[model samples]
Target: MASVTLSGLRKEYGDLTAVDGLDLDVDDGELLCLLGPSGCGKSTTLRMLGGLETPTDGDVHIGDEPVTDQPPYERNTSMVFQSWALFPRKSVIENVAFGLKMDGVSEDERRERAREMLDVVEMGEFVDHDPTDLSGGQKQRVALARSLAIEPDVLLLDEPLSNLDKRLREQMQLELRNIHDAVETTFVHVTHDQNEAFTLADSIAIMHDGDIEQIGAPREVYDDPVSLFIEEFLGDTNLVDATVAEVTETGVIADTAFDTEVDVRTGDAAVAQGDGLSVSFRPEELDVERVEGTDGDGASAVTGEITDVLYRGSTVRFYVDLGGEHLFFEQSVGADTAFSAGDVVRVSWDPDDLLAFAADGARVGRGET
Candidate 1:
């Protein structure tokens, strides 16, 4: 296993800059993911790492060696594409052994290594079956076996499970993690699926428009996104517009519409009074209840009418109209406290769970809230 690094890596097509000065490091034997939407240069970055596409500038390194100018064969890495790219006429064993055959490994050793790799992927029984007869998930497994048969320094995967159905994709995500752990090889996977990235990656670099917006573990990036794009991209959040009401030693307080005051913990960044700030909170952190007569918690509670309720099997999501702006919150639905639409609820969350961001939606400080 070897670590992969890209420094100031770029790829341009005339006027269009596909990958722009991207820098990242994949730890030796760790599975890292390059996650983002389409056209975000994830695929280009992967191809550059695999030597399938040369960078316009910067360097690519595997282990301690600079391989920016190396051809695909010279680079000690294997790539699995989205389309599987297996030869339909080749049997499973042939498909897996193809790379070794090209490398001029003896036929006996090639078939033996192919069978061993297939066993690792739990597809040894289908070694003699035709590739056309296999299902989508089986084909992907075959592709994975083929990539692993070469025993490269790093494995690059480009949405290798996108062609499968949802269930199969989920299953493959687990299988891929197991394979990564078992092989102990550096893996760099690219995908737009949040669940896939969160589950499979030890570290994730979330890219946007040819640049990495945030790079962290799944929980770190999800909880403390650095920019507006990240906040909206990772998951659902209620971004409330508010102004800094006061700055205290502990934290800064913001007052929003409908006389709702929020306490935002300032981690390290200092903010002054009247600073334009936005308070961000996850729906799961909120508690919604029927508001009673006066004397409610001044800083915590916000009186709002539940405009709609969506019962998602595990949780219930509520859309509350607080004055003109709508806020969303979620509750763990249980047998008791079963709620429905048109419920006038007071929404409140733990002060420790509130995340405060700049007006531009960039997180200011780091804390529970």
Candidate 2:
């Protein structure tokens, strides 16, 4: 197993910069994901690391070896793509053996090694079947086996699960995680899908506008996002425009645009009174009930009318209109009574769960609210 390092990595096309000054370290045997929306440079970064695309500036290293000038094969890195990239005219075994054969392995050794890799991906039974005859999942497994057959120091995946149906993709996600655990090979994956990145990677490196935004473990990134873009992109969250009214011992009190003052848990830093802030919280953290009195069971409460009710699986989502501003709150089945559209209710949440950021939207939490 080997680690990967990128120093001052950049890619440009005339005036268009696809990747800009990226500095990242993918730990040995750790699966790292480059995640972002379209044109955010995750794929471009992956291509540079795989040696498929040349970086305009920077150095790439695999373990202790500097591979900045090496070709794809010469860098000991194998890439799996969303297209599967399997051979239509070849059998599953043949497709898996192609890389080994190209590497000048003996005919007998290539076949044996390919079969072993196929078994690792649970496609051993499909070895003799034509790749054209297999389903999307089977084809992807063959593609993965093909990459592993070469025993490369690093494996790169570019949106490899994006083409599959929802159910199949979820199933493959678990299978892929299990496979990575078994291989102990360093992997760098690029994808725009948040769920895919969260489930597959040991840590996620978020990219935006050709730059690295935030890189951390899944929970750390999701729970304490470094910016407004991160909070909105990684999950469903609410951001209320507000101004700090007072800085308390535990957190800070913010006065929202709705004319309500809320106590927000200081995340990474503290802000003083009069500072502009954006208060954030997940919909599931909200507590909603009929407004019978001023008391909200100690949580900050807001009066609103339900404008919509959405039923999704065991959870029901309620969209509320609070004086022309819309906010969403959700509850699981049997955890609380469901609300109907047009119902007058009060939405409240724990102050400690509320997070506030600077007006610029950068993360400022560390209990600083």
The predictions' CA RMSDs to the true structure, in order, are 1.9, 2.1
Residue 305 in candidate 2, Cα distance off native in Å: 2.0
Badly placed stretches (over 4 Å) of model 2 are 267-273, 293-299, 333-336, 367-369
lDDT of 1 by residue, 126-210 (tens): 9999999898899999999999999999999999988999888999999999999999999999999888999999999999999
Q: Write the per-residue lDDT of candidate 2 for residues 76-189, one digit (tens) a residue.
A: 899999899898898889999998898999999999999999889988899899899888888899999999899889999999899999999999989989989999999898
**CA shift at 112, candidate 2, in angstroms?**
1.0
Residue 290 displacement in candidate 2 (angstroms): 2.3
C-alpha local distance difference test of each model: 0.87, 0.86
Which regions of candidate 1 fall more than 4 Å away from where they truly are? Answer: 332-335, 367-369
lDDT assessment of candidate 1 = 0.87
Candidate 1 RMSD computed on C-alpha atoms after optimal superposition onto the true structure = 1.9
For model 1 the local lDDT of residue 201 reads: 92
Tell how far residue 251 is off in model 2, in angstroms: 4.0
